[model samples]
Target: MKDSENAVDIKLIFQFFMCCLVAIVFLSSTYLEFSDYAQFQHKLKNKNWVQKTMEITPQMEIEIFHYRNHQSKIIFKENQQEIFSKSCNGQLELICKYIENHEIQIISLNFYTFLDKNTNNYNEFLLNTIAFKDKQGQLQTFPYMTDAPNSPQYIAEIKTEFRSFFIFAFLKHLIFAIMFLGFNLSFNVFKKSTIKLINNLIITTFSLSFISFVIRYFLL
Candidate 1:
């Protein structure tokens, strides 16, 4: 068999190294993001919060994406009613009746759904008259969160819009690709460059991406 190394050039070797780097960087970063993502998902597996706002339908699966000031994204999946009430049980039939004929504001339903692609609607609905189970197992409605004792421990709940979790995931892959290409090119620059470089921008970019990718993947 003929030795293939004879056909290899300076650029090829450099790029091979770069590819290795990219593999490392992307792999580690993806791992971290996936780790955090899994934790958020764990909550939805089985848990319960309180009923604060509108009644969500048991049939509907509510996909919840939540974040606070500079926090990683958390995605919650559960029944719509539970997600809305923050109880996140499988069903919240008892909560909806109370919200129908009540006057209130600043509730616990931090549930958000987009009206359209461009708009996010957060129904901050609270009611005075809520329904609960009566002595005879019938629906008993009464007000909630009004005198629930606003304390420092009770963090305020708010809702906001978010992009698909995959968007961040896609972005992460793109970053890895750039690193792969750049690291491959950087090692070849100012020498028998493995990466073709007739310009400076291409050279600089390739170098950084290359170094970063390599270090993150191989060394880091």
Candidate 2:
């Protein structure tokens, strides 16, 4: 009888642990999603530009279909047919407009194509993103760039901001305060331990801030 009771207790503990794990995963995922939304909102409020990255493939053929004086126009061909023409304004920073999802979007792209000597086909294409103004008159550059797909340094300014102790500490404190306020308002069970939680959060904030400073100072 005692053995059966012990086994039941262990099983209950295991189930509780699994429940906590699942809750942590759900909460963390939700937090990340909301944080990303908040970041986008902040960018929009600051009139920053959001752009998408694009890559060229060998399937697309390129031709210098038009030239006049100093300006030139290049056309893209796929399957022996011309698809779209990009016009350069005497420079490489050409505005390429394309329809995406039934909406017209503009991107500044510099296109280059090389013919394959062996295959006698234009199999090489290079594309570079250019700094340009968006429809809202916001200057888009590599530093304030967002939506750079697969880029390692996406919005790297955030990391650069963290290098400043004031910004890092302030942001950490703000995040913890928000989390504490949220828990205090939403969960009744957290009421009694509110003071304890606040103290712990304060300690954690300082500890993390100091660690960040130390690591950046010594290692980075």
- The top-ranked prediction according to lDDT is 2
lDDT digits (tens) for residues 1-220 of candidate 2? 9798777667666765665565456545544644564454344334323333443356765565444575566566778787556564433324322121222233344433444457876532334354445656665642322334223364354445444644544555455545444444443344557757765775676467446545643332
The all-Cα superposition gives candidate 2 an RMSD in Å to the true structure of 15.3
**If scored against the real structure, what TM-score would every candidate get?**
0.26, 0.28
lDDT of each: 0.40, 0.48
At residue 175, give the lDDT of candidate 1.
63
Instruction: State the lDDT of candidate 1 residue by residue for 61-131, as single tens digits.
Output: 43323246422221223542333324322233333322323322112232212122234443323233434
TM-score of 2: 0.28
By TM-score, how accurate is candidate 1? 0.26
Supply every candidate's count of residue pairs whose N, Cα or C atoms clash at under 3 angstroms: 16, 0
The candidate that wins on TM-score is 2
List candidate 1 stretches off by more than 4 Å: 1-8, 48-164, 174-220
